[model samples]
Target: MGLHPIHTSKSYHDKDELGPEGNEFTSREEVFDYDFYKKLASDPKVLAIGECGLDYYRLEPETAAKQKESFIAQIELALELGKPLMLHIRNAYGEALEILRARPGARGDVHFFAGTWDEAREFLDLGFTLSFTGVITFARDYDEIIRNTPLDMILSETDCPYVAPAPFRGKRNEPSYVSEVVKKIAEIKNLDFEICRTALLQNALSFANIH
Candidate 1:
């Protein structure tokens, strides 16, 4: 797997159920230890500071508030660490965008982005990139968005062991399936396959701040 660099992220989730499972569980307090994050973020191998953001898909109002607090704190950490944010937003783009917009200079990818072009534009305007998963292969819903997005602003991901692409739709997804995602982007944008592949590779490397 030397094909791509591995960039680990540290994030804070308010709910206990959402934290790490089993004996290795991370408590809410530990999630917000600025000094702990500073040490991890200081590591050159740990490229970014997230997969963290608002997820209002499920939660009570109080829990959602805590998620927001955690999200904002992680954003601060990314800014401090001078690394890009690896965001995971769902059913809460409006709230997420508000918090992201408040930060001004903050930048990162909206990983597995499944939002509208307008929402995507807002992220692009913030100087952030958008990464897509294997969903685009079977679903035509995202075609226009894929076509509309600037090539430099797009990257490929495989939110796997799930969202496996077509022809392997029901199986557990592996990183290799990301090539299918890349292929779909090329088809949607009507670009030559190699050009799309290289652009996406460079886009991911550049936006993720990997060497």
Candidate 2:
């Protein structure tokens, strides 16, 4: 159980939780809360700037603009802080990539990627790592992408409390289940489990800039 927790923030709701009492909270300000995140990112243990990015899976048109505005702010903060980002892109991969492309030099991972190969390649070309969740265990759609991605550009996650891997499917997920994700990667890449394991650990450390 030797695991380093990477801190992450989202550019979205729960105004009551983070908002000042009785003041009207705007999505842009609340989502990007520069001062709040700057404080957190200053912590030595805090490794990244987000789980913040675009999520258009069920977005309303009005809120979409705010979401993009918030995302850009976080991206700017990531660049300013020199910390990597932990992106959460859902159905808006195209827009997300466009924004990230415009803002060069901010390193990040596209957590729980479920995009097409072309989109994946775009991110790879832009120097971002792609992380897979336990969904790969029960679904074959990601198998090709997993096999095609280079070892250095790949990482695994549990997305825990959701999407538990096979043999543990339909149950609550935990960090320990990430081994199944690594196992799937080994099978897809046709590499020995230990080698794949070592390489993935190295890739993760490198991506997060951990020594």
Candidate 3:
């Protein structure tokens, strides 16, 4: 039941304030530097390369450029290291898809995915796994996305400290809440809970290269 923490700037700052074990990425800039990822990847505990990708929703145009640069760099690093990627995409799915298509053989999961069925299908076609957080349990739109995607391609996550599920909505999320996410996915996919759980567990293991 190990949790692989996704590193982000806010999480880094929070960890710094709390003085706890937390993964951190300074900015999109650091994501592209091979030396930085190489250093981080040296640690056996760091299993994946990112939560790295485009986020046109929140970023300014110039800043988004940096994000794309970082995203591409991290993708390259994942390929070089033979490690899976933890992608974070927002309103930039098309751009992300373009880059992914350009780089053949790059594999990863798009964490906390929010996109249309068509877009989801494109990702599936690209052979990338799609992960969803608790948002799908409460948001009608997200639930639709969950229902549309196939069970085998789906994975569950908490995106802790962010999108907590229904019962714990508005509370700080944690890895333990991944169960709620799993439950929601099971409901949407109309599959048995245990079966969904096993499949997601296998997907996680395979993505992280953990036998």
Best by lDDT: 2
Worst 10 residues of 3 by lDDT: 1-10
> In model 3, what are the clashing residue pairs, if there are any?
none
> TM-score of the candidate numbered 1?
0.85
Please give, for residues 106-140, the per-residue lDDT of candidate 2 as tens digits: 78898999999999999999999999988898899
- Misplaced by over 4 Å in model 1 are 1-30
Q: At residue 66, what lDDT does model 1 achieve?
A: 62
Residue 177, model 1, lDDT: 86
TM-score to true structure, per model: 0.85, 0.85, 0.82
lDDT tens digits, residues 1-211, model 3?
Answer: 1112222222223454222333444432233456766777767787887777776644544566666666777888778877778887877889899999999888878888888888888898888889988777787787777777777788888877776788987677789999998998888778899999999999888888799
lDDT of 1: 0.76
**Residue 81's C-alpha lDDT in candidate 1?**
80
Each prediction's Cα lDDT score?
Answer: 0.76, 0.78, 0.74
Please, what are the lDDT tens digits per residue for candidate 1 over residues 42-120? Answer: 8888778877876654445465666777788888888888888888887788888989989988988888898898998
Greater-lDDT candidate between 1 and 2: 2
State the displacement of the C-alpha of residue 75, model 2, in Å, after optimal TM-score superposition: 0.7
- On a 0 to 1 TM-score scale, where does candidate 3 land against the true structure? 0.82
The TM-score, computed over Cα atoms with residue i paired to residue i, of candidate 2 is: 0.85
